[model samples]
Target: MKEEHMAKDKPASGIPPGSWPVPLGLPLYVTVEQAAKLAGIGRDRMYEYVNSRADPIPQMRVGRAKTLIRTSAIPDYLRRRETA
Candidate 1:
């Protein structure tokens, strides 16, 4: 069933199955801390991105008190940093 879903380009469950997805592909979801670490930014900065009402934001809310950042958004986040 998992392989079938993978073949169809769908996640194993309609709901994402883990704290983070394997293979590091697009539409990836991760916790705030994880996302921040991946983005190479401070936790507060990550929150800023999550809370910002601006364009090119990189954060998402998974559940109440549970926020996720998309892996696809990482490049853009890094690009926002001049040195990155």
Candidate 2:
């Protein structure tokens, strides 16, 4: 079907297509690039944080292949920055 092909054509971001219900809600976590876009910062900066041990925004490593940032952590980190 056309819908099936459309899903296949979309790039993979580790998550398998249709593995979960769409329109359910946004993901709890996101790739570093998505985090960067959400925070209006560069991807490089996000990567730096991921590498740094003292980073306020915590990152998760999945099987040594993918790095993700918690969606809730982004704003929390920014607030911490403001207070500090």
Candidate 3:
């Protein structure tokens, strides 16, 4: 394929390379803020959901003050909710 004719494969996020902390393809893991952005919600809302018993966005408690969410969670949820 000609260089100019070929499409440049990029992550779906549309975020420039190196700007995002995790890979948009299949992130190994993500932080609260990252998860929030991926989930299309605000950071405070993400925290609220995480803290709620009926947690909509699940996260793993790391030690005392840290939390980590499976990077694929958002994508899987989105896939499930995608319109047929």
lDDT of each: 0.68, 0.76, 0.70
* Worst-scoring 10-residue span by lDDT in model 1: 18-27
Which prediction has the highest lDDT against the true structure?
2
Worst 10 residues of 2 by lDDT: 15-24
- For every model shown, the clashing-pair count is 0, 0, 0
Question: Can you tell me which runs of candidate 2 are displaced by over 4 Å?
Answer: 1-24
RMSD of each: 6.9, 8.8, 8.8
What is the clash tally of candidate 3? 0
For model 3, how does the per-residue alpha-carbon lDDT over 1-84 read when each residue is reduced to its tens digit?
764343376555566677664575857677989888988978997677667665355567888999888776666654654699
Candidate 1, residue 8: Cα displacement in angstroms equals 14
Cα-based lDDT at residue 18, candidate 2: 67
Q: Pick the candidate with the highest TM-score.
A: 2
The sequence of per-residue lDDT tens digits that candidate 2 reaches over residues 10-67 is 7455466666432347677899999999889899987876777776477788886998
Error of 3 at 51 (Å): 0.9
> In terms of TM-score, which candidate is stronger, 1 or 3?
1
For residue 34, what is the lDDT in candidate 3? Answer: 86
C-alpha TM-scores of all predictions: 0.55, 0.61, 0.52
lDDT rank order: 2, 3, 1
lDDT of 1 by residue, 1-84 (tens): 977768677565565655453444634677777778876789898777777766446666666778777776766666775562
> Candidate 1 at residue 69, lDDT?
73
Q: Per-residue error at 6 for model 3, in Å?
A: 32
